[model samples]
Target: MAADTAKVDPMHQFAIEPLFGSDWTFAGHNIAFTNSALWMLIAGICLWIFMIGGMKREVVPGRWQMAVETMTGFIDDLLEANMGKEGRKYVPYVFTLFMFILFANLLGLIPLPLAMAGVHAFTFTSHFTVTGVLAIMTFAIVLTVGFWKHGLHFFSLFVPHGTPPLMIPLIFVIELISFLFRPFSLGLRLFVAMMSGHVLLEVLSSFVIDAANAGPGYGVLIGGPSFILMIAICALELLVAGIQAYVFALLTSLYINDAEHLH
Candidate 1:
């Protein structure tokens, strides 16, 4: 029960711990080495190691090559299923984003400050900043592709080709609103899901510890239920982490396709 009583402030726990203390500030913002940035670097390293090292033209791939090929095939399938043949062109960006987010989410599970996933501070995954930055980059890529493919006609995206003149203004307003919200919605979706999952885990684990020492029989009874719930939540979080990463990248690809196709 004493251990349970050491309840970390939920808000405080979310705060980003500086990677190098106060020595890394840039302007007014806390420019400290963040847990999120650390994970980003780790993700980059993992991507290089897996993709670069696994490249092989052999008839029978080495084990590492096979693993990389399997993942690449999976991403290819996902793109084909969702975005069609044109999706192939965007594979490089999609694969990079997937690996980065997937590694960020998974590695955060390890016991290191760099493993902070949903931390609130300046860290990437915890706050919306990291997600926001990624969202903007994705948005730029999508918008660029669209405009490049269609030229000035890209503005026509908001102006449906066959709409009656009377309904044009209304539809245009709606489209504009959606376009503006794209980055915010994308960033918020990932950040909120990850943060919520971590909070639930922490809260439940605390309850389980508290329940385990209340009394002999009652503690056993209470702790049993609490422990089961914690396990369930942890499993759910694992699923959410992977699914959310996929979702973020998928939407990014879709958004880019939309800009390109005007649909």
Candidate 2:
């Protein structure tokens, strides 16, 4: 039974085989080209084309300009709601993040040349390397902007305005922990949501297939429910893609505000 089950490669569900030789060389180093890179490239290109190609403004607004404007307006509202009038200054960075993550998540949704998060044998979305990079980037941005705006006073963020003398040390430690964990929390939230959605889709679909393989009548009965679940998961993923992007961007803007004002 184990051998028979092993014969059915779960890896095959994500049909995108690696794009390089076994000794996949990159800059004289053997580096395999996984589907993650392919999708990341797709994400990058999609962002470039949409942002640069669409918003070439002149006199009257074109279709692309209108579309771009709509997205920007939505982001503007998000910033305004969270950070008030002061938030608009951070819009450029926030919007860029929104577009990048938006495209990345959207690209993952399509069953094209790469595995969609949970569909892969090992959930790529859960890969800490990717999440770590995102976390580091956000961390660096917060540090850079904070230091630039407040210089040494940015450290004061960890020093609360109202604190008892005895609790000062304890408060400082707590604030340090919270500040340090911000990027990790942000990245994990996005990764977990995407990974879980894809996993559900694959598991449900696999169950249906496996059930059918067991017996024709059993397969038929399971097929309807399993397929429905798969479709619903796919739809949920669409929402996840948008929401995750927005959430990431929103957090980024909030971080920027923290930096600028040190509050």
Where does candidate 2 have its weakest 10-residue lDDT segment?
114-123
Give one digit per residue, the lDDT tens place, for model 2 in 1-263.
Answer: 64366234443443445665658787998667766666667677878888774558856788888888888888899889878898887778778778877887777667743334434333334455676677678789889988887898888898888889899899989998999999889888988887777667767877777777777887789866888888988888899889888888878877777887787
Model 1 spans > 4 angstroms off: 1-5, 25-30, 111-123
**Local lDDT at 145 for model 2:** 83
TM-score of each: 0.85, 0.82
Clashing residue pairs for model 2: 24-31
TM-score, predicted candidate 1 vs. hidden true structure: 0.85
Candidate 1 lDDT over residue span 4-34, tens digit each: 5555444555666556656766676667666
Measured with C-alpha atoms, the lDDT of residue 260 in candidate 2 is: 72
